[model samples]
Target chain A: MTASRKPVPKPTPDTQPFWDGTAAGELRVQRCAACSRHCFYPRPSCPACGSGELEWITASGRATLYSYVINHRPAPGFEDDGPYAIAVVELEEGVRMMTNIVGVEITPENLELDMPLQVVFEKRGDMHLPLFEPTGAGL
Target chain B: MKDAVVIAGAAESDELGKLPHLSTLQLQLGSARNAMADAGLTKDDIDGVACVGSPIQIAHSLGITPAWLDGTGVGGSSFLFHVRHATAAIRAGLCHTVLITHGESGRSRVGAARMAMGPDSVLGQFELPYGVLGPTTTFTIPALRYMKETGLTHEQLAEVAVAQRRWANLNPRAAMRDLITVDDVFASRMVAYPFHLLECCLVTDGGGALIVTSEDRARALGTAKPLVHVLGTGESADAPIISQMEDFTSSKGFRLSSAAAFAEAGISHDDVDHVMIYDAFAHVPIYGLEDMGFLKRGEAGAFIAEGHTSPGGRLPLNTNGGGLSYTHTGMYGMFAIQEAVRQLRGEAAAQVPGAEISVVLGNGGMFASAATLVLAGHRG
Candidate 1:
C-alpha cells in the first residue's frame, strides 16, 4: 500500500524557492553569478562553474518537446491514468526537465518533436507540481 | 600491453530463470564457488573481492579474507567497472587474484530489500512527482528521441527483438528460446510507446562471478578454461538521473567509456569479432552500437533491421540472446561479460566461428553510467 501512494517533492533550502515560485504561478530557475549560465532542479551552487553564488530568476515559462512517450503501463498511484504522456521539455533557458504533457490527447500522432509548450501548475498536497501543455491549444 | 589481466575463471549460479530456494547472497556464494572451482583455485588464492551486491556478505559467507575490496554499485555495468579496477589493482600490486560477483533475484525477489524511489532522492524529487517509477517509463524519453532523430519506425525496433531471438534460438540456456518474429514483437503488449513486451529484457533470478588475475599467475595455475585476456577496459560515471543526460538521442557515458576502452586496446571497430551490447530494452543496443562507435549516427536501427549483427552476419551480437532473450537478473552486465569471454574462448553455444576479440559494453542506472571492456583470445 505504501508503494501506491503518490510521490511528493521534499524541498531543501536550496530548492525551496523554485517550489514557492510554482505555487505563485511562476517558473523559477537558477543562474550562476560567476558563469552566467542557468540550471534546473535547483541547487545551492552552479554545476557549470562550481560557484556558490547562484541567483534565482523566473523562467520564461516557455519550452519545447525534447522527447516523450505515452506510458501504457501506469505506476501504482497512476493506475487510473493509463497511456499518459511523460515528456522531457527543453526550456528556453537552456535546461531540460521531465514533466507530463497535458491539455491535449496523449498519443504519438498528437506529440511531435520540437512542439512548443507552456508551463502549468497542479497542486499535490502542499507541493505545486509543474506540468506542461501545448502552446496555444485552445482559442 | 600495459599489463596482462585475464579472466582466469567465470560461471553462472547453480540455475537461472527461477530459483525460489536461494537468496541473492546464496546465489553470489554459489557463483563464487563455481568460478573458483573452474579457475582451480581456493579461497586462500583470492586476495581481492569486488561485487555490486554485498561484497562484505560474499567475503564473509565464502570465508574469503581479501586484502583489497571494491563495492562499486553503479548499476548492471558495475562488474565491468570492477574488471577495470581489478586490472589496475593487479598491476599496482594491490592484490593478486580478484573475485567480482553479481547476484540478483529479479524474478523471485527473495531476500531482496525493497527499493523505494524515496521522496528524498534526487530522481524522486524532480521526476517521481510526474508518475515515473521504473526504467520502462524513464527510458521512454530517450527511446522516443532516438526514434525522432533517426526517423526510425516501430517495425524497425521490432526487428531488433526478432534478430536477437534468432540468436536465442541457438542457446538452450536462454530463457525464451522460442523463435520470435517481427510480427510477434509488434503483436506483444506495449509497455510504452514503441516498446513492446518482447522488446524488453526477461525478468529472471540468477547470478554470475568472475576471477581476474595477472597473466603470469593464470598461466602458472594452468586451468583448463581458455585464457580470455583483458586487452582494454573503460568506465564513465555521468549524470545520476535520466533527465540530466547530455542529449536524449545518445548516451555520453557510453561514448566516453567505449572510446577509452578502444584507445587502451589499440584496435579499430573492424578488429572486433563479437559484441554484447546490453539489451535491457531494444533501444539500448541501438544506442550502444552508435555510441560505442561500431556504427555511425542513425544507423544501428537500420543495420539491426538488416540483420548485420545476427547469427551468420558479419558481426554476431548478443549470442547469448542478450538481456532480451537471455536472463536479466536486474543487473545484466556480468552476463554480457560472461558471454564475451565464452565467445573469445570458442566455447559459446551460439559461437561465432574463430572469434578472436569480443567487445562488451554495459549501461547502468538510467543511462547515467557506462563501462566497456575489450577481451581478446590471446594477447594482441
Candidate 2:
C-alpha cells in the first residue's frame, strides 16, 4: 500500500501573479516605478518610498545565498522532503527571496556565504514553485 | 506630556509548560483579575484592553470599549508595544487605566491551525514558502552564525539556560524550577545545531496582564510603595524578513530602540541596575545586551560567562525566571516589565540587591520588531 500525498497550497488572488510567472519559466518581482527600486512578495506600493506606481519586471533569476539552514525534521506535509535546505536568497535585483536550495547536497561543507545561485522551478499539479540551485561562481 | 505610570498591577496565570485544565480565555481573565486586584482596582476601572491573538473578543469579553484598542499581534513583544500605546493614551487622557494581556496554549495548539496574514503583511508570501513555520528554527540560524563568529561554545550558551533555571527554583510560580546544569544543557537533545533542547524556551499554556495608569492615580490608590516609573519607551522595526537584516549576529532594532529609550530617559547603559530582557531564546538577550550597549560587540558570550547577568552580578537579568524558565505566554515583553517592577518594589522572589533602575527590552516578531522600556523607582 502507498501513502497518499498531502495537498499543496494553491495560489490566491494576491499571489497568483508570482505563481503564474514561475510557471512560465520566468522570475518576476514588483518594482516601484516612482522610486525605481525592486520589491518582493508583490505589494501595491513600494515600501521603501511609499509610491503607488509599481510594475512587475522580469528578474535576472540570479542570486547569492545570504543565509540558510538544513531542516533535519520534516514538516507534516513535506515528510518525503526531509533534511531539505531552506535558504534566503539575495537576488541580483536587490530583493531577498526565501526559497529552497535544490540540485545539491545541503551541508555546512557545501553551503557558504555569498554562494552563486540561479532560479529553477518545481511543478506541483497546477502550481509551479521557484527553487534555487548553485551556479558556478561568475558574474 | 504627563507622566504615565504602571499604576495598576501585573500577574501571570501559570509558569511555562503545558496546562491542560485552563483554556486561553480563562488564563487571560485570571491574569487580568489578578493585575486589577494588585493595582487595587476592578474591572469597572479599566477603560482599555489590549491583547494578541485573543480568543475572547477584547471589547465583548473584557466588557470594556477601550478608546485605544491595539490588538497588534507581534508574538512575545506585543505586550510591550501595548504598554507604549497605553502610555500615550493615558497621557492624552483617552483612558485612565489600560489592561495589556496575552495567553497561549503553545504546546497543545501546535500544528492546530495555519496562520493567516493580511495582504499588506510583510510575511504574507515571503516567509510562508521557505518552511520557516516558527520562530525557533528561524532564530537558530542566526544564533548558530553568532556562535561561529564569536567562538561562543555550547557551554557558554548553556549558562544562560542554567542561570535562568536557578532563578526559577526560587519562584513557586515558575514551571521548570528543577535545577539544570551546563552539562545537562550540552547533553540535551539537539533541536538544531548550536541550540540544544535545553537552550530553547518552553512552549506553555499561560497568560500575563499589566495595568497602566497616570502617576497621580497611582499615588491616590496608594497600594504599593516604591513606584516603578515608566521613564522612557522606544520602538523600531528592522527588515520584516530575517534575511534582509543588515547583520544576523546583531539586532539593529535593539540598537535603535535602546538608543531612543536611553536618550529619552536621560540615562546611559551604565545607569541600569538590573535588566529584564525578553529571553524567548537564549541568544535574544545575548544579542540584545550587545545591541543595547550593555556589552561590547562580539563579547556577549564572555559577558554572560563572567557572571555579569547572573544572580548578584552587576546586572541581574530576568529575576522572575524569564521566559526561559518562567511563563512565556506568547509575547513575553509584558512579563519582563512585570519582573522589572517586582525587582524595583523589592518583591521579586529572587530579588537583586539595590535594583532601583531596571531596563526592560522587548522583541516582538521574528527579531524584526523591538521595543525598549526603562523603569526607575522613585528615590523620594
Which model scores highest in TM-score?
1
- Expressed as tens digits, the lDDT of each residue in B39-115 for candidate 2 is 77777777888887642375567676666677777667777778778888888888887888766666666322345
Q: For model 2 chain A, where is the 10-residue window of minimal lDDT?
A: A1-10
Question: What would the per-residue lDDT of candidate 1 be over residues B156-231, giving only the tens digit for each residue?
Answer: 8888899999998999899999998888998999888878899888899999999999899998878668888999
Off by over 4 Å in 2: A1-15, A32-36, A52-55, A136-139, B14-16, B53-68, B110-124, B145-155, B181-183, B224-226
Model 1: how far is B124 from its true place, Å? 0.9
In order, candidate lDDTs are 0.89, 0.76
The CAPRI class of candidate 2 is acceptable
Candidate 1 positional error at A134, Å: 0.8
Q: Judge candidate 1 at residue B367 and give its lDDT.
A: 87
- In terms of lDDT, model 1 sits at 0.89
Q: iRMS for all predictions? A: 1.1, 3.7
Lowest summed-lDDT stretch of 10 residues in model 1 chain B? Answer: B113-122
